[model samples]
Target chain A: MITLHDIGFSYGNNHVLHDITTDFHPGEIVGIIGPSGAGKTTLLRILLGELTPTQGRINNSSSANIAVGYVPQLDSGERTFPLTVEEMVLLGAAAFSRKKPWFDQSEKREASRILERLGILQLRNNRLSELSGGQFQRALIARALMSRPSLLLLDEPTSGIDLHTRQQVLDLVHELQTDGFTIILTTHDLNWVAAQLPRILCLNGTVTGDGAPSEVLTSQVVRETYGANMDVIFHQGRPVVVDSVNNGGNQ
Target chain B: MSYFTDPFQYDFFSRALIVSVLIGALAGAIGPFVLVRRMAYIGQGMSQSILGGVALGVVWGLDLYFGAAVAAGLSAALIYFVRNRGVPVDTAIGIVASTLFAIGVAVVSSSRDRRLNSANLLFGNVLGVDTEDIILVALVTVIAAIVLFRNYKTLLAVTHNSAVAAAHGVRARLMEVIFSALLAMVVVTALRVLGVLLVAATLLIPAATATMTFRTFRNITIASICLGTSFAIIGLFLSFHRNIASGPAIVLVGATVFAMNMLTSTTSQRNRA
Candidate 1:
């Protein structure tokens, strides 16, 4: 279990997070949503031990070494190295290999299995530059999964992806949660949050709302989290967020 | 065959041949990372900047490569320090390269009894390559090869994405420092073989050509070394027969190959489209 206690971070003076105390329970999926620069990615970075909190400590009470896997929201638009999709995925296991120069047979098989699970096994030998948007996203996920990580962090997994891919990601998240992997993700898709996420952590430099969609969501909280005039409406007992300004004139 | 084999029978040509081959292989092995990282300018800048160090070595009776290595290392540090204070990388490189090159020119012009030959430093003299020069290049090439082999994957991982590489416990900074140091050594070793004017040509063109021909990083690396070595051999032979400067001949060979690769790859890609 990993818990952040009073985790406040700042970039020299521009404070990003303020006392963000949260924890991820084992075998749970939590979706964090907020506007740009809401420290959603920053929070994930802190959790991954990429950055030390400027204020508090991250408590990982587990005595065992936790294999943490990460899928970034976007790859840099720069031309990536000419690594095959399989090689990119194999990088997930590179850290765990005992300083070996090459991936052994078992590791290669595991990579193939992860690629198959992500539905891009046939495209394994293709260069990363050749992958389409949805294919690239799936490859990123497959790479993360190659580490056999007990904890997974995906930043903006739904951004820049097709709706079909979005649904596939939703289904995959559900499947992974069932497999006892604790997952944390940040997204801008409120509809995805309402439809699937059991818990939502809303943020605007801090935790504005944290609970199930119905309990934590309100027009005030939505405005606070996103800094937009969007309003939430219940559709078939689930919250469907709509821009109130666009639909306000009709009502 | 005799015409080609005749050059190898001479001691100087053979020595120059060995140096150029190692330069090609080393440059090929390392060039793509430099280009992919967008450090081609840095490579050129550092190679030119080392002239000041080399000139100072000539004046003070120090080992040429030692002075070159020190100078390159210092220039990189100074540029980094300047860039950290809000200067752009290109601007920093420009400032450092010009200052050092001017200082080298000043040193060369001021000394009445100077042993330093400007043409040799700028254009290289392949016929002047001695056994010592061959030994120096061979030593550096072996070091570069061993380091590349030991940390190939991690270095490539960092090259892909440093943030992602960090997640795998690869220290990007450490790798960078190692790379820079090795590059400095490579440049120093190349100072007499390729000269300051053409180090980046060998350092980048081979790998750039390979990138178009190969789809995988490993194959690209292998291809780059082969291409670089071939270019060096052919370039040396061309220089021997055509009575041209070895450095320019080598770069011309590499440039020609790169141009041909670009032409074919683009046409093939367009055909596929």
Candidate 2:
């Protein structure tokens, strides 16, 4: 649905993204994995049209206009407003929709349905600050679903989450994929997000590798992308990624 | 009956009361966004910063309202720009507010303009309100209220998270400009009648009390308007009865109500515990 031809971005003299060329086809579950300063979040913002690439053009070659759902890092979205979970979710729709101040019956019902689907219907009236991490992540997902978007962008879904919450988010990604939502998420770790995706883009200041996890998760590309040695060990069918430095020292 | 009806008999006194009520409603209406966005200090800053503009207007023979609006609006835009450019919000506000306030003090103290009465500007003269003041206050109040009501959802969303809203295709920049404009209107309107020292009272105090009183933003806003208007009316009565400036009287009433609300809420929470 979208094609990027040689996109580059810079901050002052620091080039955050360098000649990043890729295509996001329809209904593809893709993961972008990179180190802390690899501009993963910057790239996500670029795709969301929130930030303009300092160079190159992004072509939305698809004939039909695509709607996008964006879930920012859960901790970053504002909690200062006296917003209920349902109200926050509905804001996704309201941002795209210039409806009346008072929500219509259908919008309210839709918000309720999404909350129920996310197992947060009981928390529909709870404030954003009142939610736990897992619940907040779920709330963000529910908010994204409010737009019924075909394309969803999640930034750092597991960066600050506990193991259980991480598993829940991974499961949510799986469920969203099954429901025909084209999901793209960014993560610094490979075992969490990249390993689960059908395809992964390894980035460090640019696109280091782009392909399936098996084809691209080779130790060479992993080292190149992360600037450190990482062991890509296969057990049965799944790949177990371990820090080579940590593993070697322990052994 | 004679004592109660005494103030209402005078035409100027009635005008002052009506204008104060309008100021209360508008200030209250815009206050929640201020509190929620945590821009109360900015509101206070802009209010005082307008003193410089009023001084400049007097020295240059310009309309005081126009000068104050320009100053307040410019300050808001400047602060937003600086903050967006990576300056911390507090630092940006602090620098802008203090510089403008200092300039105003310098201008007022130096210019010796007979029309620039420091006492009236600082405390506001309730008896000084005229017909044009009534018309201006009414127009601004009604328009601001209607605009706020119509765009509450969009404003709420943008205020919460502009980046997220932008992803959903909202023009966050435009919403911000409108918010700044609305804020300027509230401050400028209140500045003329309430004085800079007391403008925050109409805004921060009532809105703060409303938030303490209600759970939903809508309820809090409605409560703020009700509380603000009540404070204005009661304050106006007290001002007339005690021969105090209306601005100080209104602030005193608002402060009292805010204290009461805080006390009761604390008691209720303790009881529940």
Q: Give one digit per residue, the lDDT tens place, for model 2 in B114-225.
A: 6677777877778878888899989988888788877787888788888888788677888888888888888888765688777876888889998986777778889998
Backbone clash pairs for candidate 2 read none
Query: Where does model 1 exceed 4 Å of error?
Result: A76-80, A98-101, A245-251, B112-115, B269-273
Docking quality class, candidate 2: medium
TM-scores for chain B, listed for all candidates: 0.95, 0.94
Q: Across all candidates, what is each one's fraction of true contacts kept?
A: 0.41, 0.74
Q: What digit string (tens of lDDT, one per residue) describes model 2 on residues A36-62?
A: 999999999889987799999998877
- Strongest candidate by DockQ: 2
Q: For candidate 1, write residues A1-251 as lDDT tens digits.
A: 88889899999999999989888899999999998899998998887778888998888779886677888876654236678999888887766664545778999999998889878999999988888777888888887887678998898989887889888888888898998999999998888987889999999899999989988899889888877777788988998888796645222
Output the number of the lDDT-best candidate: 1
Stretches of candidate 2 exceeding 4 Å from the true structure:
A96-99, A245-251, B1-3, B80-87, B111-114
TM-score of each: 0.94, 0.94
